[model samples]
Target: MDAGAPSEGWPLDDRGVAYGDGLFETVLVRDGAPRLWEYHLARLARGCRVLGIPMPAEHELERPLAQAGEGVMVLKLIVTRGSGGRGYAPPAAPAPRLRWQLSPLVPDAARWKVGVRVRHCRLRLGLQPALAGLKHLNRLENVLARGEWSEADIAEGLLCDGEERLVEATCMNLFWQRGGRLETPRLDRCGVAGTLRAVLLERLPIAEVDAAPGVLAVAEAVWLGNSVQGLWPVARLDGAGGEALQRWTIGAVHRRLQAVAHEPLGYPTRLDD
Candidate 1:
């Protein structure tokens, strides 16, 4: 199904809608099979534990996901604490609601081949270690950051935390190459720990660090990654004043990373491969 099959419209008491109390996963489905299914489920389970919501059984989600049909598509799974009362307190025994949605998988490899432009977002991510790295329902910061850009050519917006340290993009994990070393922002303080980013960190010799804005000026190349769109090399980066801060050619490093980006996520791929 293209959307959720809830018996009724959104209940007024749904904790997800009311307080943004839920966890979600966006999976890549190919030929009726979910890619990186285990990783996605693991993240969801971790989120559920953090939010104190009952985790849905694996088969409960697999059954609905299999109904998405064949071919490449984006499958979204959401688990919320169902209906709740009119306060900040959560229900003791929560009955979680599972919702699934499907959407077409449009390719952007053509644009990625040339590279894409990214700009600095004025909005800063709040540092909340408790909520950091979880794909929970609360994403107002991302929504506001993404809203800062209206240009269609600007593929994504780079974000920084309140301390002015580079965290990630609005909806993707960030990676940059410097002196032949690959480094990405450490999501220990804030930012979503995307499934693809996890896989890359495990497979590639990438370092997780707190990068500042100045790091981009010296970077050989920058990348934005997500499960749905994969990895996109940055052609240019714009500062807060809309001035070009850095430019990178789609070089050998990007080509090599792009190769691994297309590999199946069955196991932790060796970096030497």
Candidate 2:
């Protein structure tokens, strides 16, 4: 593995840059060890198989991760089908390129403890089952949704699909409690299957369903989560016009799941006042 500078130049015709033909993973590193390492690799491998890109050996990826040293940081790994092809068609034999960069991570302690404010996005995600769960390079939809809000207090925007089914947040998977049951959107048709969501699915009894946005209004509680931020309880949900649509109080359920994520992701545990 090469610890080359992230500023190094790549060919302009690289498939990842030309047509967004690539996969990437954002890993959280703490004290020189990456959290959810296997899960991240598994997701990357799945994406490579789907995109027909070659998957590099685990040892090659581990060297960069081990160099994170002490303190918290984020490591972004990108794998692309190296430059060379005819028009839109890929080359007969593709050589994959692997690049990784590490940077310091600052924890959001206040948001984790007091919860965050979120709003529904007007932009809807288009369905593509083939690329549904992979964190591929194409992210225009998320970029647009995130741009919908510029308020410093609004932490995230909830995205739904064209079919009116709530999908996920701009950058995280969403979960809510309603009717005495824990439910999350079904990502089979669209949305990124976040690593932390994968971990909770294995350890908890949450159900995946195709539900409408109205469910959130009646939900007992709502939360948005990802590998890097762990879990953030949703204190309020607003509409595009800034109308309060739903609200939740930070409670036991939030702390319970925080405890579950704390072990793997190192999120700080907080007690209810």
Every candidate's lDDT: 0.83, 0.88
Candidate 1: where is the Cα deviation over 4 Å?
1-9, 265-273
The residue ranges of model 2 lying beyond 4 angstroms of the native Cα positions read 1-5
User: What value of lDDT does candidate 2 attain over all alpha carbons?
Assistant: 0.88
For each candidate in turn, the TM-score is 0.93, 0.96
Clashes per model (N, Cα, C within 3 A): 0, 0
Candidate of highest TM-score: 2
Alpha-carbon RMSD to native, per candidate:
3.5, 1.5
Q: Can you write out model 1's per-residue Cα lDDT over 202-228, one digit (the tens) per residue?
A: 889999998788998888888888877
